[model samples]
Target: MQRPKPAVIDRATALRYMGAAGWQPDAAATALLDKAEALVLDAATPRAALRLLPRSALPTEGQGNDLRRHLEGCSHLLLMAATLGGELDKLLRRLELSDIALATAADAMASVLLEQVCDALEAEQRTYFLQQRGLYLTGRYAPGYGDCPLALNDELCLAIDTVRGCGLAVTEQHLLSPRKSTTAILGAADHPVTGYRAGCATCHLQKKCAYRKRGITCADS
Candidate 1:
């Protein structure tokens, strides 16, 4: 079932995503943001899927205990995919400096907007599962986190019918094309939500991360 679309984008949240991507914007960056936001409106489209997947579908071995621990109490998996349409890539096809920066900023904004949309969708699911049916949610665990190989993306995209559902595909390298899209797994828990907080350790930028010094979390984006 579909939920209400999220409200207009939040500048702070978009900045947070840019911060996670390691681009501290100056005035020029902020200016890029306006154009980027317009591009998001014109060029991006969000897609997602929700299902009560059996835990067996998730690889419980390897990938460290962090992911397994997170899903320990859950009975099902929640798979979702959201993407900015291919228009952004078309916008980036030109090999020019100006286009490069615009493509980069717009890509960052797409990440934030996609997450914002999914967060809203996740919240709606949590409300229904918790208040109406008594369940909780684990934070989303995308492939490439910890020891979970990116190759698993193939399995996930296939399971969720991402190509048909959202025009998403996983390359042989396990990368999702259109570059600004993501697929993730969340667990359906039986107790109150706990033990998951966005932190430097779990972030994609944890390697030589500046945010770690400032006590920031990548997932905040």
Candidate 2:
């Protein structure tokens, strides 16, 4: 839904991406990010969709107790998918042969750019859900985020008509094709919800997460 012309790649986010590789990027990482961001914007085709479902339909098995508790208050689910298409993958492949370091930096910049696209998509959907359905949205929760089962990746295909609707597919390994795409479920409620923590802190993977290592929370990331 949002290809955000030239992704507003910030220094902090680039550093966080480098931190994922167990390193850090300089303030000038944007110099490199500019190149990748340009390639992504030029090649990427952004698209998204919103599907509403009853809370009972979400998967429960293949998850830990904390995740069960995390979903307790929700009455409905919102299935959303967004993709930057597959063009960037081709450029990334070429970049891989040209320079590994540049490829790594590009990968990091692409990840942050994908997040920005998702953020913009979510913001638009959040406003629409609140205005039209009178529902407050819990932040977007993706499969493999926290203890949610990676198995749900396939299920989303059915629930959201993923391939036909959004040009996304999940491999047997559970990775989304196009690499830059994302699928998430957000909590929908009739009124303001409480007693729920949000962002990366609420994630089961937060302890070992590189983003958290640098003091970044999920919502901010």
Candidate 3:
């Protein structure tokens, strides 16, 4: 399959996600975004591993209603991710310091970089899938949502090899390393997506989400 062109990270969008995470882009965050971009560009490849299997093959059993709904409305599901390793690991380690003051800068930088990378990946994936037919991206729906089990991360990792190339690894406790990486299922719909919301505003769990309390809105147009 042909790979979509990389999405340019507009400064506005970069700042939006960073701000949502309570991160202001300082010199450190700019550095992290640059480094993360290099890493993602070098490691990204067109993953044909995502076969359009029945939603039943999603590794979740109780997804009958949700899967049925998604299938009826979606044209394809796009899965894109990379393993996090090397420089990325070192970057994350630096951000994991116990001292609040010491780690704040690093944490902000990591947050900005992660969101930028995911946004770029999502844009590219959406374009590629959309070119194939009457499909448009509804939005990315990750595991651990309403009924989507976190256990499905195992299947996601196996299918995408997110650990090998991108250096992203999940812990025994099922937490993704780097604390910045993500695995999401992007549903392709026949109808056009008119809105461009990102963080908490577009999130279905916003009302009850702790992240929303921090003043994060999904208004990333």
lDDT, model 3, position 126: 72
Across 112-208, the per-residue lDDT of candidate 2 in tens digits comes to 7677778887787789989998988887667777556677888876788888887888899888988888888777788765324444544668778
Off by over 4 Å in 1: 1-7, 19-31, 93-97, 195-205, 208-210, 213-221
Q: Sort by TM-score, best first.
A: 2, 1, 3
Residue 131 accuracy (lDDT) in model 1: 88
Positional deviation of 62 in candidate 3, in angstroms? 1.3
Which residues of candidate 2, in runs, are more than 4 Å off?
1-7, 20-30, 194-208, 211-221
lDDT of 1 by residue, 145-200 (tens): 75456787888888888887777888989999777778888887677655344345
Q: Candidate 1 — what's its lDDT?
A: 0.69
Which residue pairs show collisions in model 3? 83-166, 83-167, 83-168, 84-166, 84-167, 84-168, 85-167, 201-218
Q: For model 2, which pairs clash? A: 200-218
Q: What is the lDDT of candidate 3?
A: 0.53
Report per-prediction Cα RMSD to one decimal: 3.7, 3.8, 6.0
| TM-scores for all predictions | 0.79, 0.81, 0.60
Global fold similarity of model 3 (TM-score):
0.60
